[model samples]
Target: MTVRVSRVRQHSVWASLVSDDAQALRGWLLQLGFAEDLLIPGERVDAIHHCQLDWPEGGRILLSSTGERPTPCRPGTASLHVVTADPDAVLARATSLDARVVREIVDQTDYPSRDFTVADPDGNHWTFATFAG
Candidate 1:
């Protein structure tokens, strides 16, 4: 089953980008109204709530983050989280595209979310999850 944004939004839904180039990445994200300070050089972002975006070329965007709840942009992030009712089906689709499954779908008793992870050809991380059923 194909998962949609609304499904994850039922609980706590959030997305972020952990990039190596936080400076250039932050600069690129700022153009779209992402918190420039949060992404600044040497900022203590580990615990802070920061918006992660894929928007480049600098444009206004609507993003969601704890710092800026209900962000100005839609639900879009460099790290993709796809909520699928049938995660196996979604995994098959990604596998067809040659996506690398880093983590197989399984129940995480410690965490509220049951999900798996994958890596795309570009090394972008994709997480597919669902609430424990």
Candidate 2:
């Protein structure tokens, strides 16, 4: 038996969040293996007006600094779940960054997923899971 994987060329939906310190958040995302796709600088050198970080597997995350503009989403209130082939590796990187562990790695037999959750410096919850669904 053989399995084939399909590549995703474009993503239709993206997760967006507001961060008190978008520059710092961008660095954190990079440490977690997200590639910087685009960055729009704000008035201040450290302020980020907008940024797009792409996950290697698929999908991307959009973020902007709080008070940079009026946004509906509030900072530190986002909960993002990302699917990855190697959750353990991602977890290790997150651990090295000293990110707060919200939930330890757990194997869910019913759904058949191995995942863990952590909190970014902005207090956003990020869950890395092997399950794509």
Candidate 3:
């Protein structure tokens, strides 16, 4: 069964990503606590035309496979910042997945937030922080 995003929470903006391996990217996002909202198949059995992953806290991301169609955006070149209540938990999950830690978690007194950065298998940098802004 496919999961649906909650109507209570509406998102006006969404981050978009292109992936060479859409399935693997989806798995990675799922492992990191993103819920699969939608997945549309492409021309090929294994190709994904589009996907929507909803973050537990808030917001959503749209992802598409790098296929025959030309896209201005390239895979592994996007950097996304996600705000979460628990960055430590996210860090632990990232470590369990053996994702590369691009930046160690640090407390920024100026911004008064805790954040860390990790690179997914596709090389996209994901930064999880306590500060929403």
Candidate 4:
């Protein structure tokens, strides 16, 4: 039987990021609760990993090569913006998982946003915040 594909239903985002070390980075992801990740066929720089804990809501990551030089994550390419009812609780979990504290949750006087940043195993940024300032 032949397989057919269509976009009428839905799709998930597979984000590609620059990585210098694949296994080391993936290990970090697993440690951060993204367990049982994987690397697809034919790759030299990095591997693709998945964390389906939230399934339809959470997305997977694709680790790509950056030659021999180190590269920072592409601005908006790899980010998971999550809205939480309790920002403090989320921040607690993130900090416990060794997430990078990009910004502390504070009352935004200008934009009405309260959020923080947490870096994943591969150093990809995942911002967990809410619009309620």
Candidate 5:
């Protein structure tokens, strides 16, 4: 019995963001990155909840205005980690957006990675990092 398992092709990942200030968050995201709407029609930042933004490469962020956190962690908890080519660029953008930097950008010897954490306008934390060899 030699059955090999193959990995499935992932189309996109949906990151849900529950926030009271969905409009502000959406504005920040739009300024940072993500297109208005290309694939779907009427997918703008009009609704209070169920709003989504398409990423340039792949994946989309689902912004909900339910004011209910999805994760089981604390209220202001964001463990979002994004691996990118240039972390400094992302940090610059985040800085321009006036995002609160929880963890300054630095090279971590323990994890062998360069990363930084920033808190969004709605209190969600986002971590952008680059893994090094």
Candidate 6:
């Protein structure tokens, strides 16, 4: 039998990242100003383990350290875009953490916003912007 439902409640969006060193990645995220309170911490059960950084608006970035080694995102492959009030301020914090800048802050002609991109320790691309989304 085919089950059908009318109307669904969209709850949250979760982004997961597999890291070779979850601890160091968590530290780097902390340096970028993601407070410890946002983290739910990790739990290991058998051969699986996972943790998450809860976003204020219901989204989350799940940081997992298990399974085979992960292959970092290739250039131009993918990027995580974060909308914030102040992109410059975020840039400063990232600078302090010595994160690699993939792109300097600039106003996009077409996008109608200011943003910057940086590569995390594991080579994942993250873009912080003032875009209202």
For model 5, the superposed segments whose C-alpha errors exceed 4 Å read 1-12, 38-47, 67-75
CA error at residue 39 for candidate 2, angstroms: 0.5
Superposition error at 58 for model 6 (Å): 6.3
lDDT for predicted candidate 2 compared with the true structure:
0.89
Predicted candidate 3 versus true structure: per-residue lDDT over 1-133, tens digit per residue: 4444443534568988888898899999999999999989878767889899999999999988898356798999999999899999999999999999999999986765799999998999999998775
Ranking by lDDT: 2, 3, 6, 5, 4, 1
What is candidate 5's lDDT per residue for 1-133, written digit by digit as tens?
Answer: 4434353534356676665566677788777666655222123454354567775645567665544334443424556666566779888999998899999999986665689999888788877776522
Clashing pairs in 4: none
Q: Which stretches of candidate 6 lie over 4 Å from their true place?
A: 1-11, 37-48, 55-58, 68-78
Best by lDDT: 2
Q: Which run of 10 residues does model 6 get worst, by summed lDDT?
A: 68-77
TM-score of 5: 0.69
lDDT of 4 by residue, 1-133 (tens): 4434452423365555655555565555555445454544233434333222331234555554444224566523466665555677777866787778877778666554677877766566777655522
Give the top-scoring candidate (TM-score).
2
lDDT, candidate 6, at 93 = 90
- Least lDDT summed over 10 consecutive residues: which range in candidate 5? 38-47
At residue 39, candidate 3 shows an lDDT of 87
Model 2 per-residue lDDT tens digits across residues 1-133: 3434454344568999888889889999999999999999988778888899999999999988887878799989989889888999999999999999999998976775799999999999999998775
Task: Indicate whether candidate 2 or candidate 3 has the larger lDDT.
Answer: 2
Candidate 6, 39-128: lDDT as tens digits = 443454322145666544334676656453354623223467776678898899999999999999999876568999998888889998
Off by over 4 Å in 2: 1-11
lDDT of 3 at 32: 95
**Local accuracy by lDDT, each model:** 0.48, 0.89, 0.88, 0.55, 0.66, 0.68
Model 6 sits at a Cα RMSD from the real structure of: 8.6
For model 1, how does the per-residue alpha-carbon lDDT over 1-133 read when each residue is reduced to its tens digit?
A: 4443442233244444444433443443343223432322233443223444432222222222323333333222356555555666666666766667788878767655677887644455667666523
